[model samples]
Target: MHIKTKFFGDIELSTEQLWHFPKGIPGFESERKFALLPIEENLMFQVLQSTNDSDIALIVANPYTLVEDYSFDIDDPTIELLDIKQEDDIFVLGVLSLKDPLETSTINLQAPIVFHTSKKVAKQMIINDNKFAVRHIIGSQPSLTKEEA
Candidate 1:
């Protein structure tokens, strides 16, 4: 299956790489299909490109790499909707917004895109009543990082 993407040009994707979002992401209700493409070999970041819209694409990364203590509970409703069977089946990714210097980039932690890697089903779950924000500074939590001499 060939998909036209914003970041990447025409690319071939296997059916297994296509993710289905029944409810779709917030504001992107009509855009349901997305393909996860690795940015570079062994890189932690990936491009979540929408198959339906050429302009709809987001650079995502595992929040764990940026924030080690990051933790959140997935609502039961989303779990059932996505047909998640076990915790190991899930993979979480955060949308990244790159800015000047790149280190100024922020990730949307309040809403995470959770996927059942085996089933190929995913959903963008919105978190409410949480301390996380849509634009949390990545690698900027000075208090959380320590340096050694």
Candidate 2:
């Protein structure tokens, strides 16, 4: 199906892009439907483009890559929502806020989007981890810009 994307603009999206979020995501209650589009080379980050509204999109990435020690338990309710089964079937992604200089971008650890690929189900889960910050700097930018301000 062809849908308008904020980044790619009028592009064709595969049926798999139609990811269903049973109860919808927080703040985006009405925007339950989203399509995962690649940001760049790294598969770690992608754009959670909303089908309902072209402008309503989010830059999401695998928070685990940023915080390797990151760990959280998925409650039964969430499991039922996404129809999650084996742990391997599930994947986690966190929203990111990009700031100037590229290096200033941060990850939203408080809420992570969990996806059940097999079922094509997704959910934005809010975790209660005191150690986890809603916005945390994972690393400085790559080679070209290594100096921190």
Candidate 3:
């Protein structure tokens, strides 16, 4: 289907690209559907574009790329919401806040969007851990190889 996006403009998205967020995201409680669009030539980041709203798109990346040691447990409610069965079933991604200088960009580590690949279901889960911050500098950490990313 052809849909207009905030960053990518008009584009064609296959049904497989669509993800269903049953309860919607925190701020976007009504925007439940999203399309994960990858940025050209950039393997580290992707645009989580809201299918229902043209103006809603968030830059996301695998937090593991920057914080290799990052770890968090999914609460019982989220586990049931996403219907996650196993550890390998879900992948986590962090929403990024782009800055004037690219190096100063920060990622929201406290809340990571977890995607259940097989089910095409996703949820933005906010971790209650104090160790994880809402804004974490990106370039301060070591980079990961494509395989790792």
Candidate 4:
């Protein structure tokens, strides 16, 4: 199907490429369905575009790639919501807050977006731990080099 996007304009995607967020992302509770679209030439980041609304796209990335020691337990409620069975069944991504300078960008580590691969469902699970910040500075963390990304 074809859908309008905030960054990529109009594009075609398979139905399997869409994700269903039953409860949707925090501030975007009304927007549930989304598609994880890759940024051209950038492996480290992706556009989590809402299939329902072209203006609601968010830049996301794997937190592990930005933070070396990033670790958090998925809350019981979220685990049950997505029907996650095993570690391999889910993948996590964090929303990014881009800044003027590339290095000044921050990622939301406190709340990671979890996707159930098989079910094609997802949610932004908020971590109860204080070890992570809502806006963790990406520049201070060890991340993939430009060549690697």
Candidate 5:
């Protein structure tokens, strides 16, 4: 199917490239379908483009790459919503807030977008824990003690 995107402009996509968000992402509940489009030459980031709306696109990346210690449990409600069965069935991506210098950019670690690979379903889940910040600087690295380093 051919669809227009905010960053990528008009492009053709296969059915397998589409993802169905039953509950949709926060604030955009009505926008259900999305396509994960890759940023040219960048494996760390991807654009979560709403198939229905050209303006509704989010830059997302694997939170683990930015925060090595990032960890969270998939709440029971989300598991059931996405029908997730095992760890391999799903992968998580955090929405990125691009900044002018790029190094000043931040990622929304508090709410990670979880995708079920086989099911083609996804949801942006808000973590109940306060361990992660809403806007974690992408360039910031976790400080390690001298012993650990």
Candidate 6:
């Protein structure tokens, strides 16, 4: 299937590539289906493009890459919903909030998108811990090197 995306423009996707967000991301409850498209020339980021709407794309990355100490627990509800069977079955990603200057960009560490790799199901799970911020500054975080960005 061909989808018209906001960042990547039109691209081909298969049913297997479609991720089913049963509850959808917050503020986008109606947009359930999404595809994680790789951003060419940049391995650190990926585009979470909505198959339903072209304007609903989000730039996402593995929070662990930016914040090495980043850690969160998946609630039982989300585990059951996504049918997460084992530790290796699940992977997490954080949405990136881009700014005019790339260094000022932030990532929403408070809510990480959890995915069940085998099931292809995902949900944006909000962490209740006060240690994380919704707009965690990416540039100031540890482990991000000049080459990585």
TM-score between candidate 3 and the true structure: 0.92
lDDT of every model, 2 decimals: 0.85, 0.83, 0.90, 0.91, 0.91, 0.89
**Model 4 alpha-carbon miss at residue 133, Å:** 0.6
- Model 4, C-alpha of 67: deviation from truth (Å): 0.2
- lDDT against true structure, model 2: 0.83
What would the per-residue lDDT of candidate 3 be over residues 1-149, giving only the tens digit for each residue? 89999988999999888999998999999999999998876778899999989999999999988776799998888899989999999999999998967778999999999999999999999898999789988876543446666
- Which stretch of 10 consecutive residues in model 6 shows the poorest summed lDDT? 140-149
- Candidate 1 positional error at 38, Å: 0.8
Deviation in angstroms for 133 in model 6? 0.7
Candidate 5: RMSD to truth: 5.9
Model 1 ranges with Cα > 4 A deviation: 140-149
* Per-prediction backbone clash count: 0, 0, 0, 0, 0, 0
Report the CA-based lDDT of candidate 5 relative to the real structure: 0.91
lDDT of 6 by residue, 1-149 (tens): 99999987788998777999999999999899999998777777789999989999999989998986888889999999998888999889999998867768999999999989988999999889999899988885443334666
Off by over 4 Å in 3: 140-149
TM-score of each: 0.89, 0.89, 0.92, 0.93, 0.92, 0.91
Could you give the C-alpha RMSD of every candidate to the true structure, in order shown? 4.7, 4.3, 2.5, 2.0, 5.9, 2.6
Question: Whole-model lDDT for model 4 versus the true structure?
Answer: 0.91
For candidate 1, the TM-score is 0.89
Model 4 lDDT tens row, 1-149: 89999999999999878999999888999998999998876778899999989999999999998988999999899899999889999999999999977789999999999999999999998887889999998995544445774
Q: Model 4 compared with the native: what TM-score?
A: 0.93
lDDT of 2 by residue, 1-149 (tens): 77888888988888877898878788878887889998555555689998888998899888877887888999888998887778999999999998877677899898888999888989988888888989988676342222421
